[model samples]
Target: MSELCHQAGDARGMEDLMVDYYVDRPFFDELVGLFHERTLAETRAALEGGVEWIFANCYYNSLSAGWSPAIFREVFVPHLRAQVELVHRYGARLDYYDDGKLDASMELIADCGVDVLETCTPPPVGDLDLRRAKARIGAQTTLKGYVDLLWVVKHGTPELVERTVAEAMEIAKPGGGFIIGSSDCFREGTPPENMHSYFQACLNYGVYD
Candidate 1:
């Protein structure tokens, strides 16, 4: 990878780097295998230290990385499946984090036996359809995060926060597989009143009965 970048010259753009290092590269499989091995080692160490959940942050979201369904199924899925198996063997849950355009890959991740899928970013900022996701993979995987932190949480009114939370609850809360949270961590300047409303709405609608 470094060699490719060096050959491409310092002024080469991100597109050049992406093509050289990721897309159709001869060393892709070898690099992926090495990363998988390192991740497994880290997961094992964390589990041995009594971690209850393994957070696997996959940087290969298809929207930006241009990964095809074939590449995802053939190359990535097996690595994810192995991680799930290893985590389960140690009695720990695996939380797969890919905070972008999950609609393309959500089912495949769930099918890998992952316990939780994080940051189900909704439309505009991302393309995840929470309703579709809930109906499809909710039974098998816990769906964490759908709230839009920037638009609805930070900038919108408290009423909007409640409404967003309520809407999410209506779709994903029924089957006991949803977790209401922001697209990412709540930003620094988010209004306190909205934060209160977000939690209050969760309490109001999150009740099972």
Candidate 2:
């Protein structure tokens, strides 16, 4: 994907080309803001009808938008803030999903007023360490993440799953602002036993008394 981006950027060399266009703060901000105004109308109305949560499948759009925290803030945050405010106005919550290197941007994202942040992956898969991110964003933002789905779940031992979930809970399940989850989607080939261990560990170790 990165190589394709480079090739397209080099060939087109246009201002609105995918590379520069995605990173262009002003252009995307206005574009997304205006776009959401029309699109969120029905969705916001649905929330008014007694929805509990509004899931902004942002990672859902990350494929086309090509994510970066910088782009997220400049282009997406303003609109995300608006959406969150809208949801809250209707007494609903907004769950923001973005699977990326979020260590630098989680704080900025927290400022956008999302109730929950999805897919907060820890390194060496992503740069986020929930222990640290909890301090930064978890004071207000509820952290929801499935930890290291591929390496730590799909290919891991039951003991590894237990140990890993325990470590994550110890760091994040404090002051009541954490939700255990896979940092990314559980792929098709994942072991069922490991998946069971994950949910079981969350129930066992994710308690806050």
Candidate 3:
């Protein structure tokens, strides 16, 4: 779809339409409705199977090649709203994997009624702030992930890793909405001692009152 837009020389139009939905509303609507139906049905099945969380994966925008916030709100929010409603209908918490820079879209996501957010990165490497995000979402949503996988977990010493855990807790833990962990997986070559350090740190410092 994007390549087709590139061929047509209409960047703004492509993003705003978000799929040719503007030009071919009927087909787009039909396909989108089909997806919604299947997703909702599967979600219902999961609920019946005793799952408490309905997870989804969406990596639409990033700090590098992101669309306007307006475009996302107009083009994407409708579908997300419907999915969120479905999850809530089944009494399951809704959260999606957002593996890109979400500093700009966090507010919009919260508006779509997500119960929890995962893989939230921190700045200087990625673009997020734990304390600020906590303040922004308040009790409306839960924020998870933050400890750096590469710099701190893989490369940095165990002490640095411990400090990272302590700091993440200090900032976002006080309010009861943070889950401290790596931004993603600890790489294949990540030191075994580092892995030990991470779990131990979590146990030693992550106690809740």
State the weakest 10-residue window (summed lDDT) of model 2.
1-10
Number of the predicted model whose TM-score against the real structure is largest? 1
Clashing pairs in 1: none
Q: Model 2 Cα displacement at 97 (Å)?
A: 1.0
| Model 3 TM-score on a 0 to 1 scale | 0.80
TM-score of candidate 2 relative to the true fold = 0.81
Residue-level lDDT tens digits of model 2 in 48-155? 788888777664334224455565566556767777888888889888776766777778778988899878977777678777888887788899985899889999
lDDT of prediction 3: 0.71
Task: Report the C-alpha lDDT of model 3 over 102-171, residue by residue, as the tens digit.
Answer: 7788888888898878678776567888778888984778888888898888998888998889888888
Ranking by lDDT: 1, 2, 3
- Backbone clashes for every candidate come to 0, 4, 0
Residues 42-64 of candidate 1 have per-residue lDDT tens digits of 78898999999887777453443
lDDT of 2 at 95: 84
